[model samples]
Target chain A: MASPIQENLVSKNAEYASKFTKGDLALPPAKHYLVLTCMDARIDPAAAFGIDLGDAHVIRNAGGSARDALRSIIISQQLLGTKEIILIKHTGCGMLTFSNEDAHGLVKKNLGPSAAAEIATLDFLPIKNLDDAVKGDVEYLKRSAAVPEDVIISGWVYEVETGKVRRIV
Target chain B: MASPIQENLVSKNAEYASKFTKGDLALPPAKHYLVLTCMDARIDPAAAFGIDLGDAHVIRNAGGSARDALRSIIISQQLLGTKEIILIKHTGCGMLTFSNEDAHGLVKKNLGPSAAAEIATLDFLPIKNLDDAVKGDVEYLKRSAAVPEDVIISGWVYEVETGKVRRIV
Candidate 1:
């Protein structure tokens, strides 16, 4: 039996595909930029950030961690020609509510010691301050040699409370 | 002075926030699911996958790589109560067009030796066969100790040309 989510995806995608066009868009983003944001459900990068289809790449992960996004960002910039990055972390993020130890403990409790051991060395990249987290990510990208010096990178805080995004750095 | 992207984000966000209302959604995804998809510019997870705000966590990386997404997935499933994972890769994915060495070479060419050294050992997680990639991600999650045995996992492919998704595993 297909799950409800799976069913919904099929039906919704059918609707979207029926109206789909622009199948000839190129591999590289048309606008030469990417947005790195959290995977938080509340923030839809395309609608919330004004990105149109084929315009930009969107790299999202927990806390919108730039460190975790390094590989993708490098590919986006070096190979595919994205020249700018807009990295946005958000308010009331799950990352802000826990520490690495807390995450380790949760895995230990939920999936046992083997699972805990699997993630023992992992850094959850939790943040205590939203503004500082955004600024820190911007600085990390700026200083990283993998990220070219000329690529414009800015950071922002998305207010999940209000569907608004404010620049942080 | 704001860049065009920055200025556009501020103005566009103001329009979104002007009518924003769902401020009471909880941190845990309301539907207890997460969608892992590529950061491809043409794929919009929310619109394409039928995810509503607060419905599910959406994790995107270069290839919708389960390995790259492991930490975030663990946090989502273990700490935040997401019970299902839908991992989706896509047609015309940038990952489909390169090897790890190709990525490394590009980094060296574009950002020089120091930048290359920084990501010398990094795996860009490029995909060779799209079906195998999706199946591999599904199998990886299914077998991972960090992802609980009871968690439902499925894989799919999003056709950039058609705006359609078809099940893979």
Candidate 2:
């Protein structure tokens, strides 16, 4: 039996597929750019950032950490020809709420020692300041050897409270 | 001066924020689940997967690689209370088009030897078979010490040609 969420997926997907017509969209993003943003439940990158169905790649993760996203970013650029990256972090992010040690301790408490050992050395990439995080990710991408020098890179903070995105770097 | 893409973001974000009202949602996803999907341009997790604002976390990376998204997944479950994982990869993904060696060669040619050397040991996590890839990721999550055994994990393939999602595991 499917979970309730999975059942929701089936019915909603059926609804979406019934009217879908952009089946012929190409593998490469049509506008040759990508958006890297937080996986925050409240932020919808396509709606807020004005991305059409086939316009750009949307890469989301916890905190929208650029270091964590470097692998995906490289593949998006090298293999698929994306030339621009818009990296957006956000205000009131969970990354700003805890430290790596806190995460380790939580795993130990929540899932016991085995889980703790599995992630003992992992860095959760927590953020100290929202503006600095955005600036830092943009700078990291700019200096990354894997990222081409000429590729356009910018950073922003998405305001979950207001749904506004302001440029940060 | 901002890039054209950045300009688009500013204008579009203004439009979104002008009508925004859902500012009271909590930090943790209300539905306590996450959707891990490909960063492919054609896939919109919100509309296709039936996720409302503040409903679930959405983590996207190249090919929706489970390994690539491990950290974010850990954070989502351990800290944010997500109990289910819906991992979805899609047909016509760019990841289906290249091997790790092919990616390396493209990097070497496009961004020089230094760029290639930086990612020399990095696995791009390319997928060869769609169904096996979905099943493999679901199995990986099931067996991983970091992911609790009680977490409900399922895998699916989103067909870009038809916008339909079918379960694989």
DockQ of 1: 0.84
Q: In terms of docking quality, how is candidate 1 classified?
A: high
Point out where model 1 deviates above 4 Å.
none
Give the per-residue lDDT digits (tens) of candidate 1, residues B53-91: 999999999999999999999989877899999999999
Which residue ranges in model 2 land beyond 4 Å of their true spot? none
lDDT tens string, model 2, A46-162? Answer: 888899898899999999999999989999898888999999998899999999989998889988999888878898999999999999899889988999889999988888888
What lDDT score is found at residue A100 in candidate 1? Answer: 87
After TM-score superposition, the amount by which residue A42's alpha carbon in candidate 1 deviates from its true location, in angstroms, is: 0.8
Best by lDDT: 2
Docking level for model 2: high
By DockQ, the best candidate is: 2
**Residue B104 of model 2, lDDT score:** 88
Residue B26 of model 1, lDDT score: 88
